[model samples]
Target: MGSFLGFSALFYFLLAINMGNLMVSFSQEGLCSAPPILTSADSSDQPRYWKVTNPTLSPAHLQDLPGFTRSVYKRDHALISPESHMFGPLPYWTNTLGAYLITPAMGSHFVMYLAKMQENSKSGIPPRDVERFIFVVHGAVLLTDISGVTHSLNVDSYAYLPPNSTHSLNCDTSSTLIVIEKRYNYLESHIPDLIVSSTDKQPLVVTPGEGYEYRDLLSASLAHDFNIYIMDYKPGQFLNVKEVHYNQHGVLILEGQGIYRLGDSWYPVQAGDAIWMAPFVPQWYAALGTSRTRYLLYKDGNRNPL
Candidate 1:
């Protein structure tokens, strides 16, 4: 009996010790849970902000970007052949258009052009079927729609068009216009070609040499799926409004000043500013600077609208 009792006491002591240890462990788990493991992946997912100290400097650690290649280097009027071991030849000035350092050789999903409107033309270029985003880089233009309603656009003004919308431009003064044409997909509604009258119309007169314009200097494809253009604007100009389809867009203000209306918010935009917009967001702009407002615009896809 004595031996059995001793054995039972030993078992109870062991059980109590184990129960106390379990309680301690449970309390510790509640009070001192292991900290979450920090990792590089966590940091990478966090938002990053970069401020421009020097606009001329290339962005750091940018080589990982898609289709990134070294820009062609030019010296005083001479094109230097790249070192054999390095990336191919740098871009030559003649190969560049407007402010773009390089343009895609073949077909681009989007095509950008810089054109000047003839002074005082009662009827400027009529609207066509293409999806167009126009930024009035300089001077003034009156945009008239099919209904004959006219909206005046000046420097820094922008306009976006949905497919098949009819519009026209009337240059009160010789004006510089930056035009962007985006290709649409087969699923999109068809945009008919622009129709214009062949007859001459009364042209507005302005000082010929006083009108000048420049476009986005750095046009590029980002992420192999989107086309990007940077537009610079002078103050007192306006950006037009249009509906967009199949594409979302963002604007990053790199320099100067402007006012941009995205949705119901009227945001005063200046250098180092950014505006994110989705499709069909009614947005427009007005330049507020004495000089120019410069910003980057990006869009996706290369196909034309159906």
Candidate 2:
């Protein structure tokens, strides 16, 4: 009886510890989105808060946990890169697609993954009430839509699936895809169908401000609630203005190196890095290395103010 009781106690103790850690993982709510600090002073340690309906859905693993709601995620250490099934049995994952979940930093409103697909493998996204965007990094993948139209996508290719759109992926070679899924927030009546071949298309050189140029992937005609772009900056170039707005952003550094000003602190960023900036946080970026800096950027827009 004594030995049995001891074992039970040990089990309960470990369970308690696990539960405590889980709570800590979400204790700060979502990736730190504290109010923007107007001054140029470094506010790296400012209190961060992210609002989410379900905190428990966020990643609780120690390494995946972002200390604040705002984070500068480096590929080497700041982010979590788990193999497929590392997050447990997802509904549609297979060995062919190794998905690294990265949206835990943004909270429950969306999910993001850097997925690697092997050759000759297939995956499906059944009809659902969510919007999805897949951006090809390297190699090619065949995408088949609900209407039976199929096409091949190579590097810099991107497809946007509207809510309830059915699609399946068939890869011809080993490839990397940035998969971004988010609940549809209805604001406009029309959503344009998009299958953008960014590599073949010429980028519009738009200067939203000075010292930077934006390569817009989707134009305003598409009626997407969010905007996506590849921001390009020459060496020694930067955004001269500090911006504070209601739109939240998800960014992936695609190439070169730079430093980003989030809130009041500037952090070094490089290719393969990702960042989540909550709404209203002051932000800016500057190119550093000799090569041009490029980043895939996402920002929520065209929605009614909450």
Clashes found in each candidate (C-alpha, N, C closer than 3 A)? 30, 4
Candidate 1 on 200-229: residue-level lDDT in tens? 121222333333133432223221234445
- For 1-306, candidate 2 gives per-residue lDDT tens digits of 999999999999999998887776657554354433344222345211101000221123432454433333442213221211232323574535544445545453567666667766676573366788888876688888879889788777888887887778887677777777777776657765755466448465767558878776765653677767878789999888888887767777776677787776777666666667766778888899777787778877766767
Q: Which residue runs does candidate 1 get wrong by more than 4 Å?
A: 1-107, 122-129, 186-293, 301-306
lDDT of each: 0.47, 0.65
User: Which TM-score value belongs to model 1?
Assistant: 0.34
**Native-vs-model 1 lDDT?**
0.47
Which segments of candidate 2 are over 4 A away from where they belong? 1-90, 99-101, 199-202
Model 1 clash number: 30
